[model samples]
Target: MKKKVIVSVAATVISLSTVIPLNVTNPAPTEAQETQQQPRYMTRAEIPAQYKWKTDHIYSSKARWEADIKKAELLSGVFKKNYQGKLAKSAAILKKALEDYSTLSRIQDKAFVYANLNADVNLTNPDLQAALDRAEKMATAVSENTAWFSPEVVEIPTKQMNKYLQDKSLSAYKYVLSDIIRTKSHTLSQDQEELLAKLSPLSSTGSDVYSRLSTEIKFPKITDSDGKEVQLTQTNFISFMESKDRNVRKQAYEAYYGTLEKFKGSFAQSLSSHVQSHNIRADVRNYKSALEAALIPNDIPVKVYDQLIHSVKKGLPLMHRYMDLKKKMLGVDELHMYDIYTPIVDAEEKYISYEEAQKQVMEGLKPLGDDYAKILKEAFGGGWVDVYSTDDKKSGAYQWGAYDTHPYLLLNYQGTKGDVATIAHELGHAAHSYLSKKEQPYLTSGYATFTAEVASTLNENLLWNSEYKKAKTKAEKMRLLNQRLENFRTTLFRQTQFAEFEKAIHELEQKGESINAATLKKVYGEINKKYYGKRMAADEEIAMEWARIPHFYDHKFYVYQYATSFAASAALSKQLLQQGAPAVKRIKEKFLEAGGSSDPISILKGAGVDMSSSKPIDEAMTVFEETLNELEKLINEK
Candidate 1:
């Protein structure tokens, strides 16, 4: 998901995370002194000042945020009156107009992030929540006010726009101008665009209902391997799956999805309505399909989507081979769906403190050189992250910041190795934004998700390899290898399966077909059966998997970027390791610092991976097998 950029009128892309609702209740004051004490769990005040992000660097106080909001609101009206009919009058006018809009946008974004970051820390706060709500609408209102800008720009004939481009004064906006012209066909009239803007909030209705229901409904608790009861949650499902106990995995699976099954109709309707909303928007915009509408804005073609699904289907035999390896290594009589997540190498459990996690990340990113390492150090020490889970902090993790502020990370850090890898992954995002914002103007600072995952996942690969080389024993190496392989399997293979499922559903919706809970389950089960092959069984509960994936409701045709990004990053990671400094230099200069200065695919090409071809993906698939082979070698030796 793209980070929320509420500041820009030209683009208002908000990325959705796991979407778990924070259902925290305020605890009654203890008999002891009660001046803002921590809740039964930790509270916002209990978190160390160092661990919480210092947003004062962005804005000193809420008053400042409010003042900026007023300034932006004032500018929004002046902006429309000033540029509504005169974008093509002169090159100088066009340049100045864009610059002013950029300035107002930066202020708006800063205000938006300030309020929202405060709210994220203590989700139960009414004051900050209200401020955050106002900021969201204020930003959207500005966008709605400026809805005519794009269509107005599109009205200018390309030949005349090219003539305007002859002015060296507008050189900075060359690609931005070209992109507007390129997408001119999709640009609608001012009235139509405004209508769509008014309808935008309504589009999220289905998703909103889905989020509220999922968040409020409590799943059943079950016994862990330790015989103590554990609550199942979106955050801890995978953690439970990591247990050595197969029954624990089975019960967790059944219990989690079992709760989801009861709400299948509601979940199905929410998803169906969400997909229909996208389809309707695409139709109104004259796009051929919902997928085309989603992909075209990012400069991706239909064939890239087709090519990915095709290639993955062709590679199912290799996937099955990996599954068979898992079964053989586990020595199970028959591999059930529950057996897949069991760790093949039961290494001694180790907890890495957050301090050590930062150190390891800094050390692991060394191939990128001292400057990159220095950025990671600054991010760690500079209060650019909220490092612990207390009550009701947003679930899962994401890297979010306004163009004016440095990136702020939200983490629910346990001391597990996976947590360390997550630090590397998220810091990769922070570092990318840090570097890009330093080099590019506000208009160019935000990179697209298609290329964004490359930086994050590349860091993951680097960190895993760094740790793998240091493993003291075969068991340690196997654990690291096992962890690393699941990433490729999930990001490259599983997400492609997801990508294909999304395509099938969208096409079904396009044909005006009904897709209820049973329809979704049937399609999802068939895909899993084909992807996992005969070696692994698709649990009856597995079909209900679609019920919980936030991405399905959050963004249309979005998850494929994860697969595409991993392919590019894996290829680039190998290059950086093998080709050394030269490759590192190319990736840093061409990709990381590139930002949205170019289209996503072009930025990827500039970094040297041509996603238009399947070669990078194929190379990544090869690594998956090599990992299995190494695992087989280690296990047999043991």
Candidate 2:
């Protein structure tokens, strides 16, 4: 099953490793405080000159990106005028059109990436923000103009296209054309498709407005555990939650949710509009439901979604046990939401510097074969990663690249254990992109979300396993195990809970039921209860959790994929670690090389997983159970 997380507020132009909640804002510290505070902006000069490879692309300056934006605008007319009605005349024409479109798209990709990267570096810069907005609008306009291309290609008579494929001139586009034909069943009429295309901007307006408000609006002040007042900006709020102090975590949580509660009605409206947009589009395309329509394009089976939810639901008892163990380790009389963030075993919490983290990550991933490890080592050594978080730096980490350019990772690295894990995660994405781009054609390099998170999560699992084994003391081992369980619970079970809420909301909208703040809270509250079980209180503040999540506003029913992918990753990582070379060979051949050449299910099956059955999910749940049992045993012994 696919699970959605929070979506970035800027442009939904490219796929990133993960989605940060949009409300995550990092405002500039006041001038008086600036002297004492770390510089909010990292100067380019401050970046090690040797690490220039961290950003391989040259479109770094806003002025350069603005020039590229103009260049992209020039190609808009070419696609708009030439390919409109001429697509169906001949196979040769179709092939040429596809080539031209791909070339234009590649150029646009560079421009959009440049703009976004620039904007992300400084959200306070108006010029960069304008550049991003203009580039996205241009891309959308061009996309709408070319909307007829796919439907038209799909409308071509199958026999005629088959005969055309027999000619040598059209053979290069055989796969592309076949993919178009594969969508024949989903294509709407030309007029309906055109209408939907035109309406898309309007339809997405709700999300756009929500993004603006969430990212730009200021939140009220909240007190921290130290009795110091801090502004509840997006960046600080998340930082506060990650605090080792229980009181600080609780204060941050309540403060953030309290702000969200005030805007609950607006959030509900935006969410409703997004859901309605999906339902209407699915209906127009003649699908049974929005979920089916969303999955169909990626060739995912609806049964996969069903099996994921069902299997994860069956694992709820394990989650409850894990929570209970956590409470016991914390020496709390009762486990409240506040106790969740505290580390299980007390140690001098180490902060691995970015350099050390990179070195550790390279060592941890050695099991993926020497070649894989070599590339990873080069990535670190060659400056492929931008580390260190500064004020106005993007709030989260992500790996991004065009097929023509090497993958680059942007990280807001805070020296925390979680930050080390994040380094592994982003590099996993970079490695996957690197391998896919090396082995597959550009057209096939980008896989769907169903398979995308596997590589990243696998690296994280490997890192955790390595760390767990290396710990010397029982306290250290228990601490590492606790951290691992926390990751599983948050990434897997928590995401599944989010998925369930998304599904319920979509269903309600489909039934023409009005979605308001009260209704959303009630529904989410119930799902919260089910996932957490009876071990912890489902605090009323938790109901507003849905509103705080930006994913619900952007991607429709997308959170489940996180749970599914992490489950798949756990199983794959265990096999590779235990079974060695044969497992590694199978993973590389079946999963990595398969790319978008086959559906996700087939790819996973080839790599020794069957999402069609409940085996993988069940096995993942079993891992969770074992971890919980280990924690329980440790607590009892203590």
Candidate 3:
């Protein structure tokens, strides 16, 4: 299982490649994107075609998608009947069964890639929404139909499975089969698996409700520095925080958190029910706990989870020191949670055009050999990215596609330096998918989420080093270093804080304690205090922060990987800088190209960063400490 588990087809609905050939036309950007007087958000229909993804690569028309869905459903029936009771006949038969599963699964993925991407670009489209709704349900059906496959395979004795792994015909599926056998203890009976598969669609109700809350809930409008009324939104909340005016930041912070605060009860229930779903599934599987259950499929040891918290706790003083420096540099009497995100450096606001961003991404990722660079180039030119902000578009960013088509990225790009790093980050993911798809069979094409973030963050580190060398002024250098610091703060510290909170809540529920609104608030507040230390006030409203983090509802035990991956990436990037081409070769061949062929920790170890040890994370913190020391020195320079 990936970090965000693909339990059902609908889950697959939200999920990616090819290259070296360039038969596709790359359109030039629109004049507005190239040169705009004032930046403003555009509706989806208004965005230029060049800036949008060519989903046509997946399906030329709705008829093609529908035809594929119908064919897949029919194929699903035959697949279920043909392999239902026949897998134990021979090794060859088992391989055939698994191949058929991958084939049918790819069919659903293509259908879903088309429908889900369509809905994302224009989230308000009723037609697209209806199509996606059907796709979601179809995904559930596919899961239920094939629910017996794993259990049947798991029923085969481990010795027999080891023999099956030796079969030449099952070479590609060797790891897949071995993994299933390893989970034999956790594997449920066929009927229970089917019932659980059926329950998946229902399990998503809380997630759907949480998703709707982002758009449906009306937030209070706040006044900007210019005395203009502005409605606070997920898209602009952080943007407002970046304002030079403290009042605007405070108002935006209060308005957004205040809105989430009102719905704490609802979010609390949604989150608790969501956590309960995880506990119920884990309990039925006879796993020791929810965290163990979640970690098992990915081959992650519970120690890895505990070690991250343990290691991070040892480094709390560094986090507190950074906060203390932020207060001194900003000359604030008290550091409020809202006071963060304001720039400490004096660099003038700059916007790197989307076209420029693509070039920078190319330059940033060039160290990974020319073949990898070519793949990224194809992703940029081949419309693998849907760039720019638009009305009713999904906020935030992600890379998703089907096995048949190359990876596609969805971003509400706003042309800031941060956005440039984002382009590099996402393209790293797209590049990983391309290499994996080109190298591995469809079944192992997708890398686990544990390993996926490594590629992205490593790119950012490389980009930071390259650009920092080019900084001509102290302020420019300060800005870049500060941005890196924020990554340490946000991706490392903040996510670790989240990891701890999630662990506590799950443990509480496992102990049969109530996880209601009050309990949730109290637990979150306590964790916030510990994470931020005495420097942070642990504002009353900060306790409600968990309410807005959708991953708790969408995927349990997820955020911790953000911290861990950053730690691993920081270590790998250091290796790359020191070792050069050989390091890049190891990264691609051992990590990105490996895909799901091996356990994630082993994959990372092969690439030179061992997650099982505390060294990588501690080394990552060392980078943070060095960065802070540099920033503090710069602040004090005459």
Candidate 4:
């Protein structure tokens, strides 16, 4: 899903899309790196040029970047002077204003991406960081100047708006104009809208504080399986949990969550304030609840959110069955929370180099047909990806770029099976953005977050399926099968668990109940227990887990799409395998290339999955059940 820097316009906020990658980090850290010599990427200078993204393609120098920022500033002033209150005067005026807005938006996006891309690779560089700040400031200023657009457009009479919609000159902006009219009830007067825009920065203060606090946290050190002391970190916590040594996992788990336990009150206060902001905004906007306010703007039905929670709750027995199998496979007396991340079967961990990763991604993605394959080939050596970890390079992976340029990816790639999957996942995002920008206008080129992960997750399914078919041993099959089951577990079940918590807190706040540390922990622990079922030990330390989730602070009600999108892709993957080229055609034309030109549900329906109903969720559950059955049968064999 894309991240947005929201600039309040009326009761609603205008969202500028930012590249937020769904990181498929190395799931199982290799023992070879611990014992053997490995290639070092100590700095950007040491990294080969081929492995670096082509940032020059975006802007060659700081001077050029500065020039665009200056030009954008001038354009924004001119736009405001010329069209501030003139949008509803005539169809021709509205068409020109929108075109100018599009051009300005594109330039601003390019400037922002260039600064952030360079800054991410060289975090220690002050110049790059300054440039990024300047770009961000420019974005905020530009958005503020254009805050009048929505309110003015909505103020137009319905009779006149209909006539304008039929005019060919305004055809490019028809959907946007219609959307504005759709929210007319929610749109405030121009003066009120400007006041809200001015107050927008205060809304994100709690989120900013949380970010600073979390980043500054000092995780306690613990003894590793090697019997040496290692400092725990947010990034490496999960890897430690996957340790073969149960004591190491227990230490890491207790130390990590225990450290979080120290700051529970501060985290609770920050989170409570954010919840208050959501409720206040919803009340001002005339929405029935915070959930409606969040979902309505995206054209998503509240029922879709409800259906996910209901279906997943009904499917919890399957999850309980999974936990029972996990306990049996590990031969443990009791399955504690710490034991969940450790693999139940041992499979060989292979170190795949970046070049090998390229080959695997291309070959694995071949089922999508020639057009999709061609894009994959172009992405490999076309200067699209930064393929290794270097000092001060931002951690994890993501796909991002302006619509005018080819998509760019930043990855701290360590050659594991998970790294190969990351390539496919990020490239799927790149391919989707690439095709959408090529086919659609600037107004609709960016797709909704609701459908964002469908392409990426489907790519993962295709790649893994290709690899699973090639497995020569039972262990390999078990490992990959278990990996798929883990995807369903984390993305579907765990995220729904989060979605439930988010809904509960907002509802509590809406009901005028206090939301503090005690309330949050009580709610999160209960949901976590419910999702994991009775087989889990439901450790007390796990209750503090709510404090560490950055998503809750930054994005509200956003996790459910991870579950919904995963289900959609699972259903689509089955169709791709069974139906072949016809399925590929539908996926490419109706889904990948459609972009925001249509509603997300409509686009998905055109691509052959109907998320508006329960079938996709049910299909995903069936997949999880079957995978578990196959893995259990293998584990039970003499």
lDDT of each: 0.78, 0.72, 0.81, 0.80
Report backbone clashes per prediction: 0, 11, 2, 0
Candidate no. 3 TM-score: 0.95
- Give per-residue CA lDDT, model 3, range 1-638, as digits (tens): 11123421111212244343554444665666567422465577677777788888888888989998887888878888998988888987888887778888888888877898888878778999999998987787888888888888887777787788888988888787777777788989999998998898877777877777765777889999999997777877777888888899889888888899888888888888888888888999999999998888778888988988888888889988988987887788888888878877867876667777778877876667788777777787777888877658777787877777877888777777778888878877777777777777877776777887888888888898888878999988899889999989888889999999999999999899989989999999998888778877556888888887868888878778888999999889888888989998999899988878888999999999989888888888888899999998888899
If both were scored by lDDT, which would come out higher, candidate 1 or candidate 4?
Answer: 4
lDDT of 1 by residue, 1-638 (tens): 01123311111222211112322222233322143222223687765566677777777777887899999888988989998889989998889888988888877877887887787667667887799788878877777777788888889877889898777999988877777777777888989887887777878777767766666667789899989997877667877887788889888888998999999999999999999999999999889999999888777878888888887777788888878878877788788777777776777765566666777988888887888887776677666777777646666677877776777788777667788888988888888887887777777777777777788888988987788879898788888888877887788889999999999998998998998999999999999888899667647888999988877887788788878888888888888888988987898889888878888878888888999888887788788878878887887883
Better candidate by lDDT, 3 or 4:
3
User: Candidate 3, after superposition: displacement of residue 575 in Å?
Assistant: 1.7
What RMSD does model 1 have? 5.9
Q: Candidate 4: lDDT of 505? A: 97
Could you give candidate 2's per-residue lDDT for residues 1-638 as a string of tens digits? Answer: 01111123211212322211222122233342344332243564565443334332445565676676676667766776887777768877777787777676666666666666667666767987887789787666666666777777777777887887687887655655676677687887667776776776776766776766676556667677778887667766666776667777787777778888888898888888888899988998889999998888777888888888888888888888777777776787777775676777776765555556776887788789987786676566554566655455655677776655566677766557887898888777777767766666545556666877787888999999889878898888888888888898888888888888888988998999998889999999888888887878667788888766766776766678878888889889989899999998999878876556667788888998776787878888777778877866776784
Which candidate would rank higher by TM-score, 1 or 2?
1
| Model 1 local distance difference test score | 0.78
Error of 4 at 282 (Å): 2.1
Residue 299, model 3, lDDT = 87
Backbone clashes in candidate 4 total 0
lDDT per residue as tens, model 4, 235-322: 5677688888999999999999998889888898899989999998888888999999888877899999999999999999999998
lDDT over C-alpha atoms for residue 213 of model 2: 61
All candidates: TM-score: 0.92, 0.88, 0.95, 0.91
What stretches of model 2 exceed 4 Å from their correct place?
Answer: 1-56, 60-68, 164-172, 217-232, 242-244, 381-384, 390-393
Q: Which regions of candidate 4 deviate over 4 angstroms?
A: 1-46, 122-126, 389-393
